[model samples]
Target: ARPRVGYFYTGKTGSQLLTEKIKKLQVYQYQSMPVVVDESVSVYDAICTMFLEDVGTLFVVDKNSSLVGVLSRKDLLRASLGNSNLEAIPVNIIMTRMPNITFCHKDDLIIDVAEKIIEKQIDAVPVVKHTEHGYEVIGRLTKTNMTKVLVDIAKDEII
Candidate 1:
């Protein structure tokens, strides 16, 4: 009779192991270009940009395209519900300004970035690089991006 094969002896770890590896992957491996909106844009226009970009967050940039602020769906919703007129208000009025924004570097581990997102209760983080002027937005790491990595890992697809 053939010997029975136990699950542990199969030598193949399940999807969980693959997911663990994905979480350890570097941010530069999967980070994508951020969808940005100028700080001068009206909140109404910012909302439109969010819809047009099909993204939950937007990186607010200055004339030099440097990272200035971050705008989230909740921010827009809260501002719109307030007495202020959305059409007349610029995004900076409602955006989370720099020096307080949580940012990630391209070399950061995905898991570290994920932890920050969860801890800060933010949907996304701008991946930046130090420039002579200041931190310049290079990419963005989002919950959706991490989800995709997990899904791909589960499928055993190379990412």
Candidate 2:
């Protein structure tokens, strides 16, 4: 069967609104709890907790609950390599700066967002949205989820 035609909804529908296209687009989306940590927390505890789990990337939020920065395995490694007493150091010092961060809107088209990820050569895109308050991260757009969605699409195309 060919990939079902993608369509938009009306003022609002029920479950019918959830089409095959939407599911495919969201197949790789992870929007539950962000891997966030306090800026004041020791990198040692953060690293210990993060490593024990099997997540690919970890999002670092500050005391204000704003996106202070992002920390990757490579960043932690580099920090450890540079410091013999890395335990005392905070993740913020070694994390990628917010300006260098790439953000994705939850409402943005997934296809468009995925293209951005490819164009930027970034491993992940932080899903953020601004309310009257400030930027709140709702999810993480990661390469792993993208790959999974693409694979499912391919399977559908084959069948």
Candidate 3:
């Protein structure tokens, strides 16, 4: 006797349909631990943190551990290209400040975060939540996260 398959798909092209299905998934389903660095940390230290964490972006936090800014690989590259002192320059000086930083929440739709990343041309988005003090960084959504989802879907193992 043949084994029963848990999922099946016809020869129909359903890109839009699949996208709609993916959009229904929450960010927490695939979010990674955010790579956080203090805003006062040197740009050089931030680079080291990124390398150690194996992430392309870093979330800048303030003394209260609230989300303050965002720093990307491009940001570091730009700073390094200039004649400024990397060791003395703080990440906050070059980071994209809050209110301008694009982010999502744990309960947010993953597809929406993906769209924001694409639309904003950013490598990742800090998953945040509003606290009594301010927004706190909870997790992170990156292109890799979406790619993993796509790969799983291709293998017919989407969650």
User: What is each predicted model's overall lDDT from 0 to 1?
Assistant: 0.87, 0.69, 0.88
In order of TM-score, best first, we have 3, 1, 2
TM-score of each: 0.83, 0.74, 0.86
Considering summed lDDT, which 10 consecutive residues are worst modelled in model 2?
A: 23-32
Question: Could you give candidate 3's per-residue lDDT for residues 68-150 as a string of tens digits?
Answer: 99999999999999946899999999999979999899999988888888898998999999998799999999999999988
- Report the lDDT tens digits of candidate 1 across residue range 87-153: 8999998899978899999999998999899999999999999987788889999999989877777
Q: How displaced is residue 113 in candidate 2, in Å? A: 2.5
Instruction: Give the worst 10-residue stretch by lDDT in candidate 1.
Output: 1-10
Please list the residue runs of candidate 3 whose C-alpha ends up more than 4 Å from where it truly belongs after superposition.
1-20
In TM-score terms, candidate 1 sits at 0.83
Choose 1 or 2, whichever is better by TM-score: 1
TM-score of 2: 0.74
Q: Which pairs in model 2 have colliding backbones?
A: none
Deviation (Å) of 26 in candidate 3 = 0.9
Give the distance in Å from residue 74's predicted Cα in candidate 2 to where it truly belongs: 1.0
